[model samples]
Target: MIRRLTALAAAGVLGLSGASATASAAGGPPLFTDGHGLTVVSRPAWVDGNERTFVFTVRTAQVPAYSVMEGQVSGEHTIMVTLPEGYDRVATRYPVQYHLHGHPDRPNTVVNQRMFEETTVGVPLITVAPNGSGRGWYTNWRYPPAALGPQNWENFHLDQVIPFVDANLRTIARRDGRAVSGHSMGGFGAFHYAEHRPDLFAYVGSFSGGLDLLSQEQRAAVIASTQLPGSGTPTVPVESVFGPPIWPLDGGWNRESPAQHVGPLRGMGVAMYTGNGGDLTVDPLQAVVENRAWATNIVTRDHLVAAGIPHTFVDYGDGSGWAEGCTGKHAQPSCLIADMDHFVDLLMGTLTHP
Candidate 1:
């Protein structure tokens, strides 16, 4: 039978015990009434006779209702949390891992928690995946006025999501307690965000990421619509993603290039974990020896090395990530499930230890 307990009721349970539960004893707090009438409820359900059921919800709306209304402001955002089985929150103040999903992966990627919870079960932590950036790159693009629709994902996260998580949850929102990580485009965004705002994050992780596009033909290809020769083939949808390419603008492309911001990152005292899936190949060019994306990565890495940035780089190939150039069969990797699990496991370890 599944058990459901309300905030006040759960608090009564804890108060009755008098002694902090196992989880609470370990720096993890129990889901109880926050004295201010706010309720944190944890539900335990049995599925298929295995201990896979761990879900929690915060009644933020019942608290103060800080407005999920967009437009550069912060306050109360409801977050759904999944707790580890046998969790005793009163014990420990666990570390938090902010997970960002790839395109169309928001909300869904929360399922990836199984891999993480499997390892850090006893530690008690928070994993948040807020809505709004399903297709947005989490960057503040100045081109096209509203490059990614009417929504301003970058501002929304910085202003709204972060605060909600910090205020409502028993979290150590400081740099040392928070870690940021993502895959693919999310990986790109994670690194970019850390570079721009290193103070918010203690650790950063990128999986199968496309590091940079400045030096490689990938940039040209991305801007192919803008730079098409003779104008025969229709331009690619580059404008859709980054508005019109601003090659002529002095700081336009540089703003989008993670490679350009390596210097600041090196001095930020931030921890970073990055890995590439050998399965992904770079976008192939007609005459180029390697794919454009791969080329761009090399340029980015060279820049990082030159700047002496310290970071962990992992290369795990199952043939589904951004490989530069490969015409052979199964050119891209497909071990998404396994690779993702491995990468997250590695990230947890890095953040916890480093």
Candidate 2:
């Protein structure tokens, strides 16, 4: 049965509604007002035979946030949470793994579903995927101007979504019991969260993430890929994301780029994977872009190594050339599935139970 609650009631439970006596003492700005609160837009349903999934709509003060179509923010956003195989059967709480979707993909996608199904075969971890609204890039916006309110992606996920999940689910709910991973843009987000908020996740993984955002080449690629074809308008601009990308000088750019913030990952278990862009099926132009991203991952891996941070790097060999490695291109379901399985195995082995 679907369980629905009034916005006020949900806010009270989340400590965001004015009705909550604990609201003032919560130590942070409330995400919702008395009239705004999270709601279970859908009931829990089983998928792939075992996984239980729920859909939720969360109210955020950060509206007018960037949308995929450019220059827009969605106030009420949805997130999908999937429980472990035996969630209902067992009374024990399980560790949580937050999976982020790549650019242009929402929280719920066939790729994410397939990856989750294949990766959690023997592991028991609850997975959550919050929508990034297309071009949010999983980072708090700097261009559209914050004066519009806190349309920050980082705040939404770390502050509101995590709290909502913990309040409603049987989760371990701590750094030691949590991990984060993502593909492409999501990979960047996973690293960003882990670096910026090391207290939140014990493990982090990036698959084909554009880790080196400060590099001119990377910035160019970002602009190219995000541009609206034929119109030549950039959907996500460097100025909007992290100021001017003036490498070595742009404090904002350096602050958010994973390559520049490798210090925080010193003790965290990290995993990174990328393909050689050898798949003939993929467009040649896209292949170049993917290869460049893979190169960026390589640089990030080197930084981690130099920082004495232990991490796992998987180079799924080139598709066009000869190399011994996993087969799949960027966004290829097979490669993504394999990478998630490998990373989840690593996470499951290290994560502690409550």
Candidate 3:
């Protein structure tokens, strides 16, 4: 499916040639570096309703050093920061939540797109959005560098990005000050990062993550053969992103699968928050091939039946939109804002309580 999207994008590039290519080029303002030579960018403060949006450009030197991205070079990361409104410079400590974006396939999607503006605004917390490599899984691929090898996405977020944010910003820099969440692929990223770095985050949420990345056998079936539907097949990119000894690479997948890592997460007292597409658009064939993405919460709820991990799952079919049956139809921002209100209330209520 990624290859198909990339191909379509390539085809669009071939046809349009000039406009569409640069329209969403995902590249923005020149890369800025911190005092430590870490590439960083701070955006003009955006004062919104109850939050301020600040952006950051993360340093990418550590990714290639860790051999994570196969061919990822240093000094090539972009991140965005959004904080609660009326932010004060006097505040020496504040909570930070790193947010990741979904794929329309842009390098700096965290800043380029507005798909998740509603989620961060007015949340009373600082938000960070780091750019994931195009079509890169938010995972550290086990395979060594080769053709289309890996993107070192996990290390990019954990090692470079988070440290940079903590160092530059006046943040609490603790597990409690840290929260991670995202929409779609970003959602998966949130869970994966939280699961791996339990010592760093007390709260984790996923808004429609492509969590089914755990189904390696199924993906292999799709990648190894070209009989799949809805997209073109490219074994090279798939192999590179997921890593090899293909076919049954559940180990690499399990590293990021929230379901597989549920035991440790619950043990670590990591709060889990997850949601799915109520009436919104989601890829088909989700149930057959990749069920874990949506079902993780359900399984999580059941698995944590005895354990007391804070968890919330919401579906937006309550008929709250202005002019419609579907809440997502006309005023998505309004509808999503309402949803965010409810979710935020739930999150604050749980996390703040003893």
Candidate 4:
């Protein structure tokens, strides 16, 4: 079925509303605004070699001052969606993969660069990437400064995006058909979502994810992210993000830490991957970053192991010899691609009804 959709999309037909390939190439107005405050803001294009792909800009009430997109700072943000093949003509409903982007990143990165559509070719899934804020940490900040609007990232993804996608797209709309995964902070998000709301996701994955939020360095990293550009003016206080940042369970950080809350993920499909933070090609500092994530990943893996939770853990050290083209680790694309492949493979066995 995916092959048929690919062939049709390659043939330049069946885009949303039956627009011509030539027209879609230009990119046009909104396709439709769903009830969830999300509007299809671009023409469906054959992006990254996939069929029925488009961008949706959502104006969520969750975070009134959400992260910026297209250089605009407002409550609204963009999300890139890659619909499954045969979505328009076929009546079959497909599983949903919510691919959250990392801190300091937007959903457009996934849509434009190297492209997820390229990876998902012939894979029967509807991939959605929501622009989690650059510093929101995918959590409902414990104490967002009263000056800036709320930073309810967790609510944004769970309450707003999920329902919008399920209602607007032909999705299975249940736990058996839903999966979440991410890179870096997104990796944290994958586990965070699975842990807090186990009923919403059947599979969870993190690629170089900071799984142990309670870890000293990991806590510092989250605090540092708030200093980055998208965290908004006045810089959301670290306490708002994770309590006092003091001892073991400071500011409710333990509540969201993946390692501390692995019980809900027992039966769910769990997979984690990280390199030894050996990306010499990138900034030398990236090594430190990846090394920290790798260390935290090990802690989480140990927790999962101790809990007897069945999961796939890949400690592909440094990525130097992981594969032919693999070199460097941490935020490298090669590692992320490998992580995505692994997650997809795991999802294939669990996602319902194909």
- Highest lDDT against the true fold, candidate: 4
Answer with 1 or 2, whichever has the higher lDDT.
2
TM-score of 1: 0.60
Please state the error at residue 162 of candidate 3 in Å.
1.3
By lDDT, the candidates rank as 4, 2, 3, 1
Q: Over the stretch 92-201, how does candidate 1's per-residue lDDT look in tens digits?
A: 33346665655434332334545344544444456665432334466654442222233345555655556555554455556655677665556666777777778877
Q: What is the TM-score of each candidate against the true structure?
A: 0.60, 0.79, 0.65, 0.85
Clashes of each: 35, 4, 8, 4
Off by over 4 Å in 1: 1-81, 84-91, 109-111, 143-150, 215-241, 267-296, 319-354
Worst 10 residues of 3 by lDDT: 1-10
Q: Each prediction's Cα lDDT score?
A: 0.45, 0.68, 0.48, 0.73
lDDT of 1 at 55: 33
- Candidate 2's residue-wise lDDT over 36-144, tens digit each? 2344443334444444555455556544334433332245565667666655555555678998887766776666876776567546788899877665677876665
Q: Model 2 Cα displacement at 48 (Å)?
A: 7.7
How close to the true structure is residue 344 of candidate 3, measured as C-alpha lDDT?
47
RMSD of 2: 8.8
Q: Using TM-score as the measure, what is the rank order of every candidate, best first?
A: 4, 2, 3, 1
Residue 332 in model 1: lDDT: 25
TM-score of 3: 0.65
Considering summed lDDT, which 10 consecutive residues are worst modelled in model 2? 1-10
lDDT of 3 at 253: 52
- Once fitted onto the true fold, the runs of candidate 4 whose alpha carbons sit more than 4 angstroms away are 1-31, 37-51, 67-70, 110-115, 230-234, 279-282
1 or 4: which has the higher TM-score?
4
